[model samples]
Target: MPRSPYMHLPPAARSRTVTAVLGPTNTGKTHLAIERMLAHKSGLIGLPLRLLAREVYGRIEERAGTDAVALITGEEKIIPKAPRYWVSTVEAMPLDLETDFVAIDEVQLAGDLDRGHVFTDRLLNLRGQSETLLLGAATVRPLLEKLLPGLNVVTRPRMSVLTYAGSKKVSRLPPRSAIVAFSADEVYGIAELIRRQRGGAAVVLGSLSPRTRNAQVELFQNGDVEHLVATDAIGMGLNLDVDHVAFAGNRKYDGYQYRQLTAAEMGQIAGRAGRHTRDGTFGVTGRVDPLDDELVEQIENHHFNSLKVLQWRNSRLDFASSASLRASLDVVPREDGLARAPIGDDINALEHLLRDSGISTMAKGPKAVELLWDVCQVPDYRKIAPANHAELLSTIYTHLMQDGAIADDWFTRQLAFADRADGDIDTLANRIAHIRTWTYVANRPDWLADPAHWQGVTRGIEDKLSDALHDRLTKRFVDRRTSVLMRRLRENAMLEAEITSSGDVLVEGQHIGNLLGFRFAPDAAAEGPDGKTVRAAAQKALATEIE
Candidate 1:
């Protein structure tokens, strides 16, 4: 079989030491990896998240001059023109960039349903120039032993002890606690409650930009906030000064449906509480069910399931034509020595593209089809309909064929739309997502004559939009008091006229109902297809201030 290109590296790479550092969370696994990378002249570390990449990049740059380290992710690259070390998300790592030391964080993700194949590919392929280190859960040890014979493995015990203390009320959550929730809305709701009771709380979620996330975490770490409410994004490798872990809800929506968290996942999140040598405790809150006695005992005792097989996907499909690619994807149900991973959006989108006669017809030959197929692999962060994404790509292919460049006019217009920052939360999010697509396009430097300029413009715009969006999220979600007051002010604005006997406000001769908060029961005549009119009470409060 023609395997990954890296497998055929020279004897020097084969002679390098490969260490599998196995352990649970808070085991100093990542710290050990960092130390190894620093000991070498040049290094590359594969992080699981863009936020984590930024964190590591900053740390490495601080220690090893800014020009010595490069950071690369899907939509952003802070790669120094000449870098001695690389910090990158797993998918974005420059495979050809040789290094003295190479480390993969959260190596157990090699079995992840969505990204396991990428992780497994890295595991099977990466031959660092000097040394290679794999850091993650103990479950991966058995598979590593089977796959990489004679590989050295070391299991580290958690620096601090984790004890399951049963369930607790949200009101009873200890100080310096980190509460985990599944959704942004839930995280915000919990943070809002924490603000009311504990004065304030830090908030973190996957959608947040790295700068925003770092600032939010600093609030809790720097003692400005006693509590932190966040999503499972924390389960990866976010370090803070948290003393307790509280589950706002046991069940989390796994991009498919709401389901119970697995033992491994629970252990990972709970492990965040006790960092270093300090003993930590965890429990449930927000009416979530208590952990079963057996599970709780296993958690307190540090027992977790064993890994059986690693999940893998064939991203290295050798095909030049769309039809050949589709056929390969359809027929190759499994690969030798690797288990098939869950169906990803890329495969689904590729199928849709193949079926669409218009898009499929554009790729007249293998070379063209291969290029189009590469474009299809770029994940759509917008989460737009598959058909819409297909149409967008089809148009791009046409434009590329015509000018050998992306339709700069189209991207410019998108920037204008993204620049409109004064909008609701969903509007801002959509605009931000739109700008991200442009950023991804800009990632392909060859696709533009002035690629550097295009990238610089998009980056600045993205930063502005991200800052605006972060401000909105912080005010609407974290600063609950400000949000509530703003709502009150809006309601006050709409109640320009004194509360009429009928409880309707005569604003510009329109009978708008008096909004108690944002919504109100309208009088029979005030009802309309669009729902009741909102009394801008907050604006009224602002007018009083002006008076």
Candidate 2:
């Protein structure tokens, strides 16, 4: 193995108080971290997902005031002058900024394949001046102790129990349940089935913009929908009032290959079922096989194998040239239980750029090579193909090297194509992803000539597309009449009934059926259980008016 690039660096002093709070999901580790952070005069917290960052940012802003809080993510930046608290995604954290307190959420992601290296780098290097907190699953406890000898470790017990409930059909699943699938297609299929049989389901996927996702989640939270269909994105720190979690698909493609979820992975998702002191359950749905007895037991008990290693990559890159940078990345870790991560999208894009003779020629000196590496770090949000993504980076790097910034006309053209709000769910989702790429570019300070102006433009387009997508989803999967009637029925409240001049009977402003000559007829579209629900609600509400 090659000598470690960091071996030559002098040892640095440790933080005053570096604490690792380890536990399973719903253990309130993240909440505790935030409380500790807010207690300090100045602090920073790095979350694993943009959604989580935004959530925490809002929480912090509520206490610290928006003027005292700053949010920094790859695609979104909200910085007030001299902000005292910084909430950012782990990868976007300003490690160089010193604060009295700092915290990193989901620290166990250091074992992840695609982005583990980033988490590991932050774990090893980033530190607060007076106190530092590392929050994640209990699986990382041993690794934390081994890696940082003097580090303090605290284990938190789950606030509520998680039990396995066995298998059920999608239609038979209970209310306030989240059905988990591994892919977008599976999530949509499950959601559609739930919508037909159980009123409707709110959809959640990793691809959704924050605005769109929050809207969908609101539907479920507000009781407009009884179920939520989502990918593994919910396994993160998304707090939902889910009483049960049903796995629609047990297998997922983990960047490299398709495989069954590990026991710990299942626990992370299943654990999201209940919040606070409320117990929750997990089980299989659809054609998925029931989890084995031992696996089920382990998940319920929050017992699983601890992580043995963390993915590592050299962050101290030698930007003198592309070759040197690559070489630095290949340097082996000097510590035990640290393995080099496989080539990620950034590396793949860099390799593609290096193969291009013209691009390689232009990427010569330290500054140019560093810039090339920076451009390569742009995420492949549109997962069309690796070469296509690399081609985009090439255009960006070439423009920066030649003209100092991306041309406004060219950038505007890209944004214009994705600006339209008209499209189906899939089309609108794709447009959101496309616009997200430009949004990420706009956030880069030096990439655009007018970063602030372009950022606002991209954000506005994304919000419009997100709203359109939300509307499309709601129209397709949600039966408005059914959801409204069901919610009112459950509340045991009198429904608002109205009959139009044309003899159309509407319950809560949702057309239920037509009334003619003292006889009521349900709409043709209202059939099955939903139709029955509407009929029952209409009769109860219109009894006095009809009499």
Superposed on all Cα atoms, the candidates' RMSDs to the truth, in angstroms, are 9.7, 3.2
lDDT of 1: 0.74
Query: What is the TM-score of candidate 2?
Result: 0.96
Whole-model Cα lDDT per candidate? 0.74, 0.90
Instruction: Give the Å error, residue 126, model 2.
Output: 0.7
Error of 2 at 389 (Å): 1.0
TM-score of each: 0.82, 0.96
Model 1, residue 370: what's the lDDT? 75
lDDT of 1 by residue, 1-547 (tens): 4332256333234424788999888888888887789899988999999888988888889998998888888888787778988999998888777688899899888888778878987877786777899889887887787677677889898888788776777757887899999887788788777665545577888876676678778767766556889898998998888789999888887767889988888888888887788889899895788888888876776677877778776555646677677665654424334687777877776777767787677776776777777677667878878788877766666677667887778767767877776887667767778877777778876676677888898888778777776677566544333223333343444434444565544443444455453345443432221121222432443244334
Tens digits of per-residue lDDT for model 2, 1-547: 5332112222233423689989999999989988998899989999999999999999999998989999999999999999989999999998667788889999999999989989888877777777889999989888877777777888999999898999998888888999999998888887788778778889999989989999999999999999999999999999999999999888999988999899999999999999999999999986898899999989999999999899999888999989999999889888888899988999999999999999999999999999999999999999999999999999999999999999999998889889898978999999999999999999999998899999999999999999999999998888777888888998999888999999999888888898897889988898888888988987888897899
- Stretches of candidate 1 off by over 4 Å are 1-5, 8-16, 330-337, 477-547
